[model samples]
Target: MTEQGPVELIHLADSENSVIVRVVGATSAGLPGDGCLIAEIVAASEFANGRLTEVYLLPDDLDDWAEALELLAAGRTVSWMDDGRNPEVRIELKGPYISQGQTLNAVEVEVRDASVSLTAVRVLVRLPDDWVDAHRRKLDQVHKAWPLGAR
Candidate 1:
């Protein structure tokens, strides 16, 4: 896993603003995010002035989020960490972008961290229609790096 560096839990971006979540390491020995294999979550977004927050996300969160991405290729709207404790992401079709010489549907994204300060950023991002495929691969790598109870 070191060869590839950290796993990108999620990367939603556009021309100006972007949101990226990187899985840092495994959670504490006993405590987990409801059987969460991850510990540190690094959230960043240009839209949020600079960085958002480095919170924790349990394995269940990643599992459910992955499931949602699996259905993303079907033109579905999905969300993750929307509980407000962590950086929230809402993705849906918006416009278009050019990738691999093909035009693909864009994703209008909102990366918000409402931690009492009352700040939220919403921006349009151009993501490939099949972006889920890449996302799933990243999640697989994360699981391999930080399996349940492995720390």
Candidate 2:
């Protein structure tokens, strides 16, 4: 993502500590590929004060969670809401990692938006990773019950 400047809030949040941003629109030159991806960010600074937090981005329809994994891998954005008022969100990759650890995994992305003022929403996500041998073995066993073609 080129240094395209600060991301503007087209659909601002309701509170100062939190804001909900989604992919309202996008632009593509269609050459080198990854054009301009946009999202309406809903973030808050004071989400909570603790360790081990779980955030959910619900979908509008019934679909597999694998879809989210696919989107994140492809650099496409998504959100929890499906009000049918905007385009599908592409995961915004342009943000700062809040964690100060030497090595961080599945860290949240924080952005400086005028809507959220001094606060920001902590966007935490888990990307795809390799499955351990033991886990894969268990999955192999489970798959046997619902084989490829057993109907």
Candidate 3:
């Protein structure tokens, strides 16, 4: 919430099953001692035909979702940082139907400046089902129209 930059959603991989989402950001002045990054991972099987059974936040930087929620509930600022080395933060969700149809279905989100440059936000998701075809088609259409850096 510290004057966050733009949020970009990049699809890393999309198939029939499983999805990995990564949320990241770059820092220009480094991580603040009193700031932390809050990440929220929500997976719904109703839409993707899979239920969210597990969730993980990588880098072990700040606190987990529970801890973050606690702090936030107590009125605290959750700030994140990127020193250009670490992955910033990663969220992985697993479910029973994660690998039903295909074996390679993942979506990654990448956030960057809309104009100038610098900093980014990446989210990767893995979905299980035959939705890959539609996703691919959508991606193709988006690419054709935007070309690059259109997000």
Candidate 4:
């Protein structure tokens, strides 16, 4: 399958326990808070048909009303793993990751204040059940310590 460029990543905290991430074309789009280009999902392919075990952000072209419709689309299968560069910034989501749930079993989001782009965005799964709670707490601390507004 052919590979495509990384998508623009943006994050927003909907509430104390939930967050919203918007993935758009590799263009200069509006981002939440005051940060610019917080992080990126490098070398991401398209989402495949059937059940997905992890969170895969499908490009807008392949989705209809935010739902994937075609399996024959190019780059329909993708994977996300750590390259051992910065493991601390990796993100983790629950297994069988689906879009309809709206609430993930676990999620880890990495954020930075730099105006530059981050090369990697990691999403991890297949871990303990309680991993989400722990990560959420850590994210809360990060939000309090270095808010995107001030950065």
Candidate 5:
């Protein structure tokens, strides 16, 4: 995570491909009453680039992400804003773990932009060193920094 910049909503990256879901404007600055954020979900590969900068990442989506880490660690698949379109961020464990505290494992990430010509790219990321904890901490920081107001 970049300490000097804002916390990323979701980030999956490697040398070849990079997919990110990031919020635009302030959380409170979104629609009134509901107050939702307009996020940008981007999928970039060495060959092509796809971006969905108008995706609506609701407050409930943030709540879902907090649970996603748990499901992923438990070998369950999860997706964020997977409305059969947009840049869907789906992640799942590659295989069963060999042992407990196995910080290193394989994860499959898929970034699909069905809204624009249906662009999908999947990558097997070598999730290193307690990825769940790392991501949880980042999520925690984001929640703390840009906490949404009460309904």
Candidate 6:
């Protein structure tokens, strides 16, 4: 029997309970958002021969937060935008991190604005459940070394 490889996961959300998660291959085209690149993840039952049956965007009306949370628990990246109209909150992936066949999981995004300075932004990408404990400890170090603001 052939072993099924790990599924690629990406997630997006907002402060107002909006969330979207997608699973696809490295070469698949990502869903376009205002400033971030997102992919759509449909229900497994709805997948017809490896295609998504539906898609979603931020600020959904339905109460689907549970499902969204489940996807995050399953090792999907979770990203959230502050407000759709805020230009400073816009987040873009930088080089080296954006590569083919890589999966991001449980990414938390916080957007802030200051009077004396530009917007202060924070992004947190949670390591996978199966990752070594040492890797999780590196999260702070990684972000500390990163330059502030979006690309």
The numbered model that scores best in TM-score is 1
Measured against the true structure, the TM-scores of the candidates, in listed sequence, are 0.75, 0.26, 0.23, 0.24, 0.73, 0.21
For lDDT, the strongest prediction is: 5
lDDT, each prediction: 0.65, 0.33, 0.33, 0.29, 0.67, 0.31
Sorted by TM-score (best first), the order is: 1, 5, 2, 4, 3, 6
Model 1 ranges with Cα > 4 A deviation = 1-4, 30-48, 96-101, 149-151
Stretches > 4 Å off in candidate 5: 1-5, 27-34, 84-86, 95-103
Cα error of candidate 2 at position 36, Å: 36
Q: After best superposition, candidate 1 residue 151: deviation in angstroms?
A: 5.6
Error of 4 at 78 (Å): 17
Show model 6 residue runs off by greater than 4 Å.
1-64, 81-108, 112-120, 123-151
Q: What is the lDDT of candidate 4?
A: 0.29
- Per-residue CA lDDT of model 6 for 27-112, tens digit only, reads 22353543222234321211111222123223221112334344444545433323333212222332223324654333443434
- Report the lDDT tens digits of candidate 2 across residue range 7-124: 3222222222333333323334453322323344444444452121112222221132244445645555555223433322333443333444532224234443333335433554
What C-alpha RMSD separates each model from the true structure?
3.5, 16.5, 16.1, 16.2, 4.4, 17.1
Q: In model 6, state the lDDT of residue 144.
A: 32
lDDT score at residue 115, model 4, on the 0-100 scale: 28
CA-RMSD of model 6: 17.1
lDDT of 5 at 80: 68
